[model samples]
Target: MDESYFFKLKSVAKDRLSPNGEVAFFLGILLYSGALLGICFFAIYYAVDFKKTSELFKGLFIGSGVMIILLIILFCLCVLFEKMVFKIQKIIGVVTVLYTIFIAYFPFFYFFIYLA
Candidate 1:
């Protein structure tokens, strides 16, 4: 009876901590993917102009295209390497947090420095 009680308690704790590891992993990937898309959109938006800025336009187009390609590749990799992601869940969590911070900060910082 005591052993069964302990097992139930352990499972409850585990569920509380993670709930569902796969869901968490995919949610993290989704967030990063959205951020990458946002970056690509901003890059393209800022890069284009109706003036004679051929070089700048070309560079921005190429950079933004490359970023989109990279984002697709990352999505594919995450889908293919589910086991690996689960193994490195902690590292993924840390990186996701840092990336989120950068994504959130960039626009705010830009507006503060340039617009304000």
Candidate 2:
């Protein structure tokens, strides 16, 4: 069986470039941390209504906090497993990409459904 072109390119890059996996991993950690924090802030901001509290907003606030804590735990584990830097980077990258898609999709979806 023959390897795909992308596989060949990646192999060549990995061998010759000696990519800084740790840097990638740390960058991903930073991004995920920032995103979680932002979401937490937004959720809490929306939920802060003593007179009228929405169950959905309260749930979002709690969920965001939990996610942030979980990410912190994962960050600690990534720091401990420094040798598995590439795997950590890939995990974070995939997560960030998915989150980005969701972030982008919601607003456009609302706009299309309500405005258009």
Candidate 3:
């Protein structure tokens, strides 16, 4: 009886970690970021009708905000996909390196543009 109890306990302990831990964390981050992005989108969307209401303003307000939010979401999705599978990771890895290079090179490009 004791052996069976121990075995049962061992089996129970073995699976303590939820199988979906990574997915859970990913979703949590997605939900939080989505809320944040939604708010920023709303703020910019409203800015259209709220234009005369605020002193500081930028045209294409919604466009810029949406683009930024999308980029952020894409980055997050890419990371999640990378974590979920190595095949996807290789693709995301390439994309990530390209993105990093593009971002890194932009300063030089800007400097050149400024110099020119």
Candidate 4:
């Protein structure tokens, strides 16, 4: 009885995680990844300009806001593409999620490479 109960709970958890994972993966790829890349670029600009710290923070804030809007637009495009072009939402969604993960983490992976 106890083992069966635990198995049922585990299955339910997995079922719930699937949809949640889709959203989590989407936001992680779109928003957080874009913010990190934007911040890196902004830091380089700051280093070159020697501008006010406040300006840097302001730019970062504005850039993040812009990225959020762009993220929404891109997400809508993905949905529209799946609906109109592919007609296989899960396949396209999974592909986009995987690509986003690659885009988000590729820089970190590349950083570990050493020249021969």
Per-model lDDT: 0.54, 0.54, 0.47, 0.55
Query: Using alpha carbons, what is the TM-score of model 4?
Result: 0.41
Model 1 lDDT vs. the true structure?
Answer: 0.54
TM-scores, one per candidate:
0.42, 0.45, 0.31, 0.41
Query: If both were scored by lDDT, which would come out higher, candidate 2 or candidate 4?
Result: 4
lDDT of 3: 0.47
Residues 1-116 of candidate 1 have per-residue lDDT tens digits of: 78999999898777744524444644565566457556644654576432434555446446544644554564466567766656766765665565455555544543332221
For model 3 the TM-score comes to: 0.31
- Expressed as tens digits, the lDDT of each residue in 1-116 for candidate 4 is 68999998998877654444554566666666666656655654555332433554545446545655666665676555544423444664765665675666545632322110
Give the least accurate 10-residue stretch of model 2, judged by summed lDDT: 107-116
Which lDDT tens digits does candidate 3 get at residues 56-76?
333333443454455566556
TM-score of 1: 0.42
Each prediction's RMSD over C-alphas, in Å, is 6.2, 7.0, 11.8, 9.4
**Model 2, residue 38: what's the lDDT?**
66
State the lDDT of candidate 2 residue by residue for 21-45, as single tens digits: 4445445655755664565455435
* Poorly placed runs, candidate 3 (over 4 Å): 1-71, 78-87
The C-alpha local distance difference test score for the whole of candidate 4 amounts to: 0.55
